[model samples]
Target: MSAQLDRESSENLLSDSRFFFEKIWLNVSLYLAFKIRSVNAPFWVEDTMASSLKPL
Candidate 1:
């Protein structure tokens, strides 16, 4: 019985850690994506404007 409890506790701990890591990874990915978009936004606008203004 004691061994069973220990196994269950360890499994719970592993699951909790996995959930924590997944949350952190998601937050980091979102942050990086937002940063990239913000960094590229101005260049995107300039490119669009330049293309629109170009004479065909």
Candidate 2:
């Protein structure tokens, strides 16, 4: 029982970290796309980020 609980806890931690990691990246991407405007970035970066920004 303790081993199962430990496994579940570790899995939860892994999942939570992944969730936060993705959330942070999305926020960073959005910020670069709009806030700072990623002016010096490559055209593809701006284009892709711009398209993705519409859904949010």
| Tens digit per residue, CA lDDT, model 2, 1-56 | 99999999999999999999999998888776775454576777777877888877
Residue 40: error of model 1 in Å?
1.3
Off by over 4 Å in 2: 36-46, 54-56
- Off by more than 4 A, model 1: 41-56
TM-score of each: 0.69, 0.68
Candidate 1 C-alpha lDDT tens digits along 1-56: 99999999999999999999988976776666566566766777656645643642
- The alpha-carbon root-mean-square deviation between model 1 and the true structure, to one decimal in Å, is 11.4
Q: Please give the TM-score that candidate 1 achieves against the real structure.
A: 0.69
Kindly report which residue pairs in candidate 1 clash with one another: none
Clashing pairs in 2: none
